[model samples]
Target: MSKVYYTPWRNDLEMVDKFNKILRKSNFLDNIEKDDRIAIKLHIGEYKNFAHVHPLYIKGLVSALLEKDCEPFLTDTTTYYCGHRFSAVGMLKNAFYHGFSFANIGAPFIVADGLGDDKGFSVKVRSPLNELFVPNLFREVDKMIVFSHCKGHGLTGFGGSIKNVAMGCVTKKSKLDMHKVVKFCYNDALCDGCDACKDVCDREIPLMENGKRNLSLEKREDCMHCPACMEACSRGAIKLEELEKIAQVLPLAVEGIYKVLGKENVRSINWGANIVEYCDCMPFPGRTIGKNTGIYLSDDIVAADKAFLDDVNKSTFMIDGRPDPEIQTIEGEKIGIGKMDYERVIL
Candidate 1:
């Protein structure tokens, strides 16, 4: 079985010191060889969303890797959504403003998918997506450290190593591709003209009257496909369909990472502190769901995520109407990302 090493969320020790101890206990970096170019894949968060993994912790890991003579750098991809991280220049500026400077983190920050969001290889995976555009940076790296800040997601319930790999490792187009799988449609014939869809749609995408709409659903796709209209309509006018593929499709991106970098060459480290309600992508983020959990390190991505979510569920299950966290692990295992069973090693 996979082994997940643990360390308490304590402030008694410096962040770097605690990180080093956990790394030693878990042997998380044992696979990295000297002179290897390692990419430390991470989510640096959107503008002012400060719950991301601290740079000091990453600096500690970088120091350890440097001591072993391995070449390491921090990397994350562009966001498909229009925001601070939508482009290479914008992302770099935001990362710098967020204190992820090369001077502070002991490594340079790289926009993995490149400036135009056009550097990648199409590798095959499973259902919901045939292939993913694994960024060229991921393909070139000798190894990767998937460092995640464990938190609740409005979509996947919990975002951890699996989410870090699936969403963070791909290009902009592939990110959009994963989201587009869930079909959203509304029938004008079923409308009761209650204006419920209009009230629920925060983006004002739905144009509902007695019957017929001037705009099509295709035009609504330009906005975030949250499709809140499907739920508020008592008349069954709108139907947003998905088979939990949103949860399953995320793991396929991990398969793409494995296809290029090899599973053995990756390690996962989750910062379970600052447990919050939504993903770091949100501008306002969300409220904290539980007390600060500690850290988890494992080679098995699914195992690490499972352990983290298990702890979160002890206090609260649903952070903010998100899907159950178990669904992510179950779907991940179903798609052969990693096993759910694991042996826990306390540091």
Candidate 2:
């Protein structure tokens, strides 16, 4: 059974009606309980990125949840890199700047991983990697209404509900480990005695001498793997190794999500309209990839992602990698997370 439910983008006036029809048709709303502490998991968009799940849509969803007596709260995890969303204060400011205020979205925004990047509770899970996650606030909640703006990612090829939960709901420490696939290698031959890597090294992993420089993995152990050094290099000598390890993190990435929400207690809704090439992590907005494809709702996270991928594939527009792309959510499915084959219900 295809799990994708879709509604075309009509006039803005019909947005709430269209969403309700889609939600009702999908039957996902049936799962909510009265007065349920529903965690409305979402990305509040970066500083300048306007291409996120619209606040209007969120307010509609919030209204729907309120009707069910579900106490919905907007939620997301902070970033690993020191940025706008690295701390509760920063995330709140970014949320406010992006129009995620209680007045606008009708829900209080909460940073799930606590005030700092290190705050979270660990949960054990069964995986080849034995991925453990610091279960965030969503874990304490009774139910979750997962929302995502489907888009492409530099690493995952695409980002959807699974990506939303995996990366958006976990602590920055986990993100550092997951994204640290590539290691920077110093090119002694290209070294110009600039010691550029040493200067910008947030983890202080690189050391500089009178005329040469050396990098230590022991010191770089705290590296968040954000690739800042790759851009700062003046000689363009720093090389990345173990590139293959980067892709491996995708599957392991969702383990934390699975650990927190589990399969039974979560439902997903994704806004595929205005699909973009890059993720919402960008502080600045980018170009849209395809036509408005409406929204989808499902209890199966992998199924929702696969269904969204299929919609992207069916489109005539090219998004670098869309048509016949490998099922990126297979890693989640392999771990008994969710199904991929779905029943598409077009509304």
Candidate 3:
């Protein structure tokens, strides 16, 4: 079992000080050598959804890394969705708008994937898909500190360090490759002809034929596999199957990242504050589903995420009646990434 350090967000202490205490206790800087290029991997929130880990907290982390004489920089990949984060320039602007600017975080902010999304390298994995693409910049870093904002995720039940490494570290092409496992089947017999799927589809893959909604094979080829249609269909006609494939493949992709960076060279921190129901990629700022629980720090990404999920699920307000968030941890352990069993050390 791995040791996960926890520091509760209390009224008696300043949050930044609490974060500093956690960092001091975690011994995170021990992994960093002098002049080591450390990438602080994190998601700068989407436009209008500024619920990610606050830049103040990141400033604290940067200070700690600097104290170790390590070179630290903030890095994230360009998003796949059609939004402000779809390109490198736009993503940097969005990150600046959300207060993750260089002046604020005390580090250079880089979109790990290049301007046109062509800068990445592939790594072989145990999954049947065989390989996953990691951003070229990520490979250059000697070490990484995966800073994640723990929250509920629509596809994976929960998003933390594992999801951060799987989706946040890879290029858009690899993101789509990982998402290809989410097969959506439209049952024509259960179609209500409500045109809901047609209205929400950004790719226009769903068509209205006569009075029924039709998803052609050609259209399926163009499908981006986002769950927009699945969420819009109230009649249960469009069903998302093979979600276990996602649980299995996501950790494998994370393992690929670990293989590139070396398992001992990476550490993770999950900020359990501002726990939103959906990912930070969502355009709108949704409601917070849990209170400011605390911060989790661990060298093991899987153990850190497992502890975060376990703590969040203990709360009454869980997304979709408490879907199994532990699936990622279970799969992570099965693939030799990390262990689900952890020893929580309260600070």
Among all candidates shown, the one with the greatest TM-score: 3
Q: Which has the higher lDDT value, candidate number 1 or candidate number 2?
A: 1
lDDT of each: 0.80, 0.71, 0.83
lDDT of 1 by residue, 136-244 (tens): 7776799999999998775666788998899888887788788777666667677767777777655676674445443455766665555356657788766655625
Question: Candidate 2: which pairs clash?
Answer: 1-342, 1-343, 2-342, 2-343, 3-342, 3-343, 35-69, 121-135
Better of 2 and 3 by TM-score: 3
Ranking by TM-score: 3, 1, 2
Q: Could you tell me which residue pairs clash in candidate 3?
A: none
Count of clashing residue pairs in every prediction: 0, 8, 0
Q: Candidate 1's error at 256, in angstroms?
A: 1.8
lDDT of 3 by residue, 1-347 (tens): 78999888775248789888778876656778899999999988889788888889899999998998989999998877667899989999998899988888889998888894865887888856688888878768899999999987767767889989998989888888877887677789999789998888777778888788877887666677777788788998887776657766788888999889999988999999888877888776467778778889999999998887777653433344333677788889998889988899988
Among all windows of ten consecutive residues in candidate 1, which has the lowest summed lDDT? 314-323
